[model samples]
Target: MSSLILGIESSCDETGVALVRLPDGGAVPQLLSHALHSQIDMHRAYGGVVPELASRDHIRRVLPLTEHVLKESGTTLQDVDVVAFTRGPGLAGALLVGAGVACALGAALDRPVLGVHHLEGHLLSPFLSEDPPEFPFIALLVSGGHTQLMRVDGVGDYAILGETIDDAAGEAFDKSAKLMGLPYPGGPELSRLAEGGDPEAFKLPRPLLHSGDLDFSFAGLKTAVLTQAKKLGDDLEARKADLAASTQAAIVDVLVRKTLTALKDTGMRRVVVAGGVGANKLLRAQLNAACAKRQIRVHYPELHLCTDNGAMIAMAAAMRLQAGREQAEKTYAFDVKPRWPLDSLK
Candidate 1:
């Protein structure tokens, strides 16, 4: 029998809700509908997320978004077989909002509740795409402030290969953009400006390019951008685009090379890139070219699903059920983990 899974995501600055149908006989789940509300505009004035504000906003958005998803999917709340939520590695207050709401709904309906690891949601997000990857692929996970490479043998079977020692790729992008006076959500803004500049115009460091291990380091690169920006001083505005391009190039170069190294070491011919940075056009193009040259398949989540969303959470929950890796419990006395580790899921 098929089951309806309702998911809520309030891990950070976005409130997302989605509905997915878990088919019988272990088939891939189908996403019926999803909704997302970004706090970018509200956070823009502060230059970053305010945890308290994020929590309050989730309280206001989660139920509404869930209603919208159910309406769009032509389903009722009573039909939901399970309620899933992001339980952490996020803002403490923000996470509690999601966990509390999910458990409350589950209790009211007497449905089981599942708490999903945030990174696992990202890792499994590619399955929601039209071209889903098979098992035993190299996974490049690049979310906010976290960069990791893992060997995914199957659902719930993951081994970490490498991770960032200091700043992650997203931080390098956003920090560099800030140094160059870019606005809030600097990563995408920097990428857009890069389109008009010469990537080779500014020479930047590619940290740990030949570290002999799959580990990554971007703190040095971020420092280099700051130094270069200061040197440009009066001409910084005029050459900002060049700096943006150079910064993006440095980050992407490191990511692509490291991913390729992971594939070589694991002997995996397929790769799945997930998380927010996976939406980067330059990263996708370069990975595609390099993977195609090696006759390796590269998979990514649909662009719209790249950021934090309910679809990934619901999808993760459904997959775990199908794989028998986890069971949705009836206990609604929930707690949130604000600093959970991905590899610890095993």
Candidate 2:
């Protein structure tokens, strides 16, 4: 029997709702419709997300977004068999908004609800793309505050190959951009500014690039960016673009080199890059070029799905259910895990 899964995501600054059809006989789920409302404009004044404000906005948007998704998908609440929500490693208040709505809806419809790990949603996001990857590939999962490379053998089977010790790559980008006086959501802005600047203009550190292990460290790199910006002093304004370029280059270099190391060690020809940073133009170009020379295959989620979204959450739940890796429960006593680890799923 087929089932319609409704997914909700409010783990941070965005509220997203999506519906997917889980077919019988182990096929990949089909995304029916999805909607996202970003809180960027509302939070720009604060420079970053405010937990209380995010939660309130989610409360105002989730239901309307859900209605919009259902209307677009040509479905109704009665058709939904499972409800899924992002259950963590995010602001506690933001997570609760998603959890509360999902559980309440599940109870109202008398359907089962599934709580999905946020990282797991990102890990499996590529399956929603036109060309989904097979099992046993290397995965570079880079989301907010999290940078990890994992060996994904199958659903629920993951082995962490490496991870950040202090600041993640996303942190490096955002922090460095902030130092340069970029606007909020600095990563993308930094990358945009880098297009016209010379990447070789400034010397930057690639932390742990030669550690003989896959582990990553970007805290030192961030510090280096700050030091360089200060040294520029009055000239910082004129060289901001150059600094952004150099910073982005350093981060991308470390990521590409490390990912290549992982490929060599595992002998896996297939790689999947997911998460917010996966949408980076330079990262995509470099990875594509490198993988092509190696005669290896690379896959990525569609740009829209690269960020935190309800589609990934719903897709993750559907895949888990298909693999018999998890079971949705009728109990609606939903609780959010603000610090859940992806390794815990194993």
Q: Pick the candidate with the highest lDDT.
A: 1
- Tell me the lDDT of model 1 at 3: 99
List candidate 2 segments past 4 Å from native.
Answer: none
Can you give the lDDT of residue 169 in candidate 1?
A: 88
What clash pairs does model 1 have?
none
- For model 1 the local lDDT of residue 202 reads 89
lDDT of 1 by residue, 27-108 (tens): 8999999999999999999888899999999999999899999999999999999999999889999999999999999999
Clashing pairs for model 2 are: none
TM-score of each: 0.99, 0.99
Over the stretch 1-346, how does candidate 2's per-residue lDDT look in tens digits? 8999999999999899999999998888999999999999999898888899999999999999999999999989999999999999799999999999999999999999999988899999999999999998999998667999999999999999999999888988888889999999889999999998999999898999999999999999999999999999999999998999999999999999999999999999999999999999999999999999999999999999998899999999999999999999999997899998788795
Worst ten in a row by lDDT for model 2:
337-346
Q: How much is the lDDT of residue 151 in candidate 1?
A: 95
Global lDDT of each model?
A: 0.94, 0.93
**Residue 139 C-alpha lDDT in model 2:** 97
